[model samples]
Target chain A: MVTINKPATKLNEPSKPQKSSSPSLTAFVKAFKNSIVLIVFILLWELAPQLGFVEKTFLPPFSEVVQAWWELLVTGELWRHFEASILRSLFGFLLALALAIPLGLIIGWYPLARDLLTPILELFRNTAALALLPVFILILGIGEVSKISIVLFACTWPVLLNTISAVKNVDPLLIKSARSMNISSFKLFYKVILPASVPTIFTGIRMAGTGAILVLIAAEMIGAKAGLGYFITYSQYNFLIPEMYAGIITISLLGLLINYGLSSAERYFSRWKQ
Target chain B: MDKIKFERVTKKFLVRDEYKKGAQREFTAIKDIEFSVKEGEFITLVGPSGCGKSTLLDLLTGLTQPTKGRILIDGREITGPGLDRGIVFQQYALFPWKTARGNIEFGLEAKGIPKSERKEKAEYYLDLVGLKNFADRYPHELSGGMKQRVAIARSLAFNPDVLLMDEPFAALDAQTRETLQTELLRIWKKTGKTIIFITHGIDEAVYLGERVVVLSANPGTVKKIVDIPLKDRLEDADIKSNPAFINARREVWNLLHEPEFQGAHI
Candidate 1:
């Protein structure tokens, strides 16, 4: 049967190959050229306030933010907040992965499950996870439970929807080919359907990873004593502009690290795609 | 007993009537399709588009049940797809995740063969298809011809007595197609499997088949079965251009077009 649904992302097509190889020096030069814009942007960020293009107190110089970041690291304050955020996001993400995948597979594969759950899923799918924050807070209280639950809620839909579509959209020809071998349904699911669904499922996983971080940060900002989000907002309230900038920078770096980790994992799983 | 049998089989699909609102109709794909194949014979089914050649194959593979009759293998009615028959599709449905050798091992694994023996068998068939060096390459890494070769090896690895090929070489370029055709004939001779090959091309049908079963389109049924008289056609390099090969090709082509011409007159 033909399944119609949008993919979470464009399938990860391999990038085109380089036309020719070059010396190590040339490769280093090319790498430098690629980073030119980023270097210029960083230079401008440092210069903008120093040259009075912006108010120094409101938007501190890049050097001051770096100094503040260094102090946070030295005092171990940043590590505490970082650890708390990481724990919440990781727990929520892992929890969502555990629940959503099997649920998605059932909904995708069996008509009974799909028919029963689809309407309720549609209602919840349309409702934003953040919008349910008050309900979560009201029910689970203003502790770790509410924050983690919100992150879990946010992460679940992307993983669930993408996985359902992934399993549904496996090439019918491959299924037919496997079926002709008189393979058991169990063998067919794992051998053909599961492997075929991996690339797309990983797409969902990566999206969930991003969502986990974003939601946990937001939840922390709304109410939390120790987290990057709390640290940033609290720093801003106390008129510690450089410390706030440091918190924001830390968050960006954390996002980058998370993205890099997930991308590497995706590449490892889909090595055969090359 | 015949190696495979199709006893007055018919298939119909329940389809939504596009021009009418909320209406359904039965679309008959093939009707009363009676045929039987002898052991160790290469039979090619040739037809125009919508001839239900594929439907016939689906029934034979037991992927779909016949709406009207029974299909049997070894004189026993087919319950469902089994290990006795293997199928190769034109699209080269090799799992992209599995390497060429892994794809071949899939069926053996389904048969619950031990890992070491499955690997040995996969390698043997990979060698048979002239893809020994490409055992570890995935389907996307291989060229079109190479992918099809791997698909053929995958189907053959399990050692099914009946091999059903649905235009397995149809997607290749002319040069590649002819090369694969020659290679297929060579493999058929080596394996001595009861082969049911399907194609829309007359030349392919005539070139490969010991006998060609021509099917007419629109409620497809067997129109005629023609035997090739050339004894050494497989060994003859110039057989396609040979007078006898041309005559047989012409005969199958005429059989395919006869219904169309009759419809035009009416």
Candidate 2:
């Protein structure tokens, strides 16, 4: 059966060709073009305080923030906090991935499992993860466990839902064609279903990666002592504005790094899709 | 002996009527389809849309069960899909994750063939389809016709006794379709495998088939089986202008244009 009745003309069109230039140089130019707005914003931030558009003590100059960031980096204080935050988010994200993917596969593959679990999933998905912070803290104690649990809770929904949808919606024709070859069920799942679902699953994974960091920061701000969130809060209370700015900058850079890494990994896995 | 047999096969689907409060109703997709395909014969199933041409192929592949009767391959009643029959879909269902060679190797992999042997076999089929140099290319990197060629190679690599195709060239442009049709005839002549090709194109059916099985719609059943007299003219450069080709095409076109089959045009 022709389940997807899209016109042949649409399918026949070739994907837009990539620029035929030296790869590294082309990538560098592309990156520079993409970051033009960010570069201008940074330049403006540096000039704003230098030109006395804002008080140095209140907002701090970009150079001062960088100096504070460098001092923290040299003393290994910033590294500790950065490392701590990374480890927690990574651990939580990994745990959620481990639990959700297989479970999503099961739910997607079997209609009964989907029916049994969908209501509970939908309920948890709609309820904000932060709103459950106090409950998590009370149940798991105000420690790394609660912070990690919060991150796990925040990341699980997107991964699970996206995986379910992806697995459920694998092109029926692909499966039909495979079945025509008498492929075993196990082989079909691995060879056909799993690869077909990877692109959508990666979308979920990227979202969960970002969500893990966002929720972890919020969780850290509540009770943690050595995370970027805690560091910024502590600096703000002590009127160390430059240190606060440094923490914010570190978070932004960390976010950018995580996103870049995930995208690269996504590209590697989905090279076939292109 | 017949290589494939459909023994009074019928398919019925219970489709829900949305306007009638979701009432379930029986839709007879095809009724009492009885035909036999001889070994090494190239047969074309020509009909309008909804005539169960695809459903017949599905039954032969054992992807869908015949609700009423049995389908047999080589005197054995087929229970489910086996390695004996390979199908090429119009959509060119090559695995997006696999290269041309890899897609061709898929059936071999399922049959538990050794990796090295699978590679050699894939290469052989790639060359047969004139895509030997494109074996390493992904499906997306190839043009529409090339992709379909890879799909044909993939089915052929398995070395099945029968090749079932469902409008395999309906998606291609006219030139590509004609080229593939000629290539298909070459492959059929070389391999001597039984081919049951389905198409809505009357001219294609007349050009490719020794016998064109014309199916009628609305509880689809055999309408007319037109035996083309111009089988030797398949390779003619001006075959479309040949009187015999024109006669066969007109004959099939008239059968399809019969009053009951009017609205069934694709």
Candidate 3:
């Protein structure tokens, strides 16, 4: 009965864990290693055309795109197109906001109305704003109205849905608490529910702003005569690849700028929340 | 005249959907409950949690319509919630977007107090609740105790005829709860306002009430009403260690623990 198991291995042997002093540093090193592919991509783009690996006529180098950007800047044509696109986007976006906000508030506050209209709105929201391009072109004849309609369709959903959910998601406790204080009905909505939902509402506006700009450019590209989208299509057709690429760059920059502006607005309004 | 009265109030509830319309089961929430509060009285409704002390308060505040009876406040029938009765909820329900001063001035502004007078009233209560430095801070920025204090200040700013509170300090930590209770007493004294406080906490009921009314489990009904007359003796801190405090808590505890409270969730 005194049979004792001998040491299967070194009983007190300390198993060492792999040394990792800083996981964050390791992650940074790993990311840098992974970015080598991107570096190679840039290098290939820079060197391929110069080495005649591809036809220079069809595809200009990045340098040529930059040079085209400089020429456009000097002539102020770039700024003009940029201004036109921004103005259309702004007008359409504001118009849609004015329409959607009150409508959405009414639907959200009344359960019966929301239930009645939910299916119809679902159908319209699912129909792509771009798909209405042909209908808009026929009715508005490719003028400001057509372009504005496209932008308006793209921006409406985010603001509307956000408003509805913002109203719907107000805490029951807040309502009960307010009623106990004898707050008037109008006061309850403005003072309690609206303020409670401001953060979520801002999220919607930011999304709508970005979406309107993105869709506006796409619409403009298809039918516009003078905006940046129009200029890109014209340059591409006329064998001006560098200017075409320059237009692409400008579109991305405009999107980034709009996103930055809306984000700042959200932060400003919600500063007190945190 | 009584400040508030509920004459033979009976509340019923449907137990099931009964969509067939012909058949349904109804449960009694409270049956023939009758009580009243006097002017300048501090009445604490103490019972096991489901005893409908809060429902009674809601009736007095006109937030609910009694199914079979009537409620009178200052001999007038209660129709709906009005500015005359101010309530503090279990959760400190301050407006999150506004600063402490803004919340305090809210009622007065609605009642058309001038800008200077509003500022004066807000500042006065801010000082009373010891939140003068926190005047510009929003509710989200303040601690739980501070928010509750601001709520009290806002409620008192209107000089409500009756103060109705439903477990106002239940959400606070023990220290904060005790502090608020004492503050409430101080405010009650300074303003001479009638207070109807509801609680399941036996110790708090004894400490805060001029009279403690106890109720049995559902179908809730009043079982005992103990008139403390202990306010004079409770002036000192060490007075809590006196026999009366323990005796009151024990009496309420005894009334609450009768076989019904063992199964109730509250």
Candidate 4:
């Protein structure tokens, strides 16, 4: 159990023996510290090349990577690559969400359905997501469908499993109270069960978003000509160190943006969690 | 017409656990109980835990089925829970997600009141409960006392003819419990709605009730019904100062200590 001290608001002393929790405000402090750490690492990386900590051919300075990024942006190459990667991840995420939630709700709501499906989902989920890339390429060709399908497969399990768990584990008291009020079962599912399961569902979505990004990038690296992954691989083979570093930076930025978008949404849906 | 009338009400609960030596244990919560409530009267049901005071309330609310009984209100059989019978649960069962106003609007919504009318009705109940300012706030934002008030507001929204409460204030601190009891009595007096309260606290039953109905433990049946005479139910005066209050509390407490009820608090 963890305890945290905070600015006191009430004069009353603790009446009950309970474990304390960290305050919400500390999250901002943690985030600020992380940014400082990242900046320090970047400053070190920039100076290492100049100090001959590594060969210049093998390593690029931070300024050179920024210059390559600027050139790519002007020529629309960076935008094309970034947009393709973003679109694939988004499309894959939406498809997985569409497939998972209702199926998860059914799987979660009924014991028989869950029993029939758990083994199949477990089997598929156990196989490494990347191993399916060749099979997908063989069936759909090395194109958008193949790359998006790979991402969709990777993202589906977490969303589906989380949704199932969320729906199954709603607070029993909420159900009892609603039933006592003569609330119809359908309305109970919509009003009480659905809303109660939201926090866990959001957790699944966050996982899916990150998983989709990782899978899409890996898939794109195989054959794609216009994506962040493709740019990184293409630049690496040609030994264009700065552009390769720029591609790595682009991937980092993409991940940061996606994490921010999903986390904020999680916050919005789980306002009552505290 | 009686606000509530239960005739030959016997409830049998099945203990379906296989480990029991027999097929199943038939534990009776309430047995051969019969009672009726007068219109607009406040009646309290006092008993040990699991003595069926709450089970009786649940039966009255149509939350559970009775094995053998007939429950009637105003002339019609109570087929299921309806707006006329509002129930306040022990745990402050206000929906966690909804604002105070949202909970109050629930019954009115079930009745299909117009949006504008429902809003007005919800605000009226909120004001009556002295929580008009907190209407927009969710249940999680409020303290335990505040949440119970919202639950009360929700129950009172439709001006239910018969309000059934199962130890609503028992979960609160002693101070909050006393304060809420006063507030509840004030609401009942102002609305003139019939109330059937269930509790184990003899003091609480005597403090808020117009009549305290005591029940014997397990296979529960009514033991006695003591009338409480308050000069002014609205005014917060010294109940202990009144000899009638003292006599009624002592009578009920003595009735609870009967020999048949020995070792019955299980």
**Which candidate's lDDT is highest?**
2
lDDT of 4 by residue, B140-220 (tens): 788899999998988888777999998999899999998899899888888999999999899889888888888886788
Residue A182 in model 4: lDDT: 72
Overall local distance difference test of candidate 4: 0.85
Docking class of 1: medium
Worst ten-residue run, lDDT, model 1 chain A?
A3-12
lDDT of each: 0.88, 0.90, 0.82, 0.85
lDDT of 2 by residue, A1-274 (tens): 2133323443346655557545566667768999999899888889998899988788887889999999999999999999999999999999999999998998999988888888899898888898999999999997899999999888899999989989989999999999999998999999999999999999999999999999988888888888999998999999989999999999999899999999999999999887
lDDT of 4 at A81: 96
Clashing residue pair totals per candidate (backbone < 3 A): 0, 0, 0, 0
- Weakest 10 consecutive residues, lDDT, candidate 4 chain A? A10-19
Per-residue lDDT of model 3, residues A147-198, tens digit only:
9988888788888888887888888777876776677889888878777788
Tens digits of lDDT, candidate 3, B102-216: 9888867655679889999999999999999999988887889999999889888877889988899998999999888888898888889999898888888888898898887
> For candidate 3, what's the RMSD?
10.5
For candidate 1 chain B, which ten residues in a row score worst on lDDT? B257-266
Q: Any runs in candidate 1 off by more than 4 Å, and if so which?
A: A1-22, B18-20, B259-266
> Interface RMSD values for the candidates, listed in order?
3.3, 2.1, 7.9, 2.7
Q: Give one digit per residue, the lDDT tens place, for model 1 in B204-247.
A: 89888999998887788888899987778767878888888989
Q: Over the stretch B1-266, how does candidate 2's per-residue lDDT look in tens digits?
A: 99888899999999997779869888999999888889998999988788888788888888888899998899999889988888999999999999999999998898788998999999999999999988888889898999999999988888899999999999999999999999999999999999999998888899999899999988889987888887555458888898988888988888888788656655
Q: Against the correct fold, how does model 2 do in TM-score?
A: 0.94
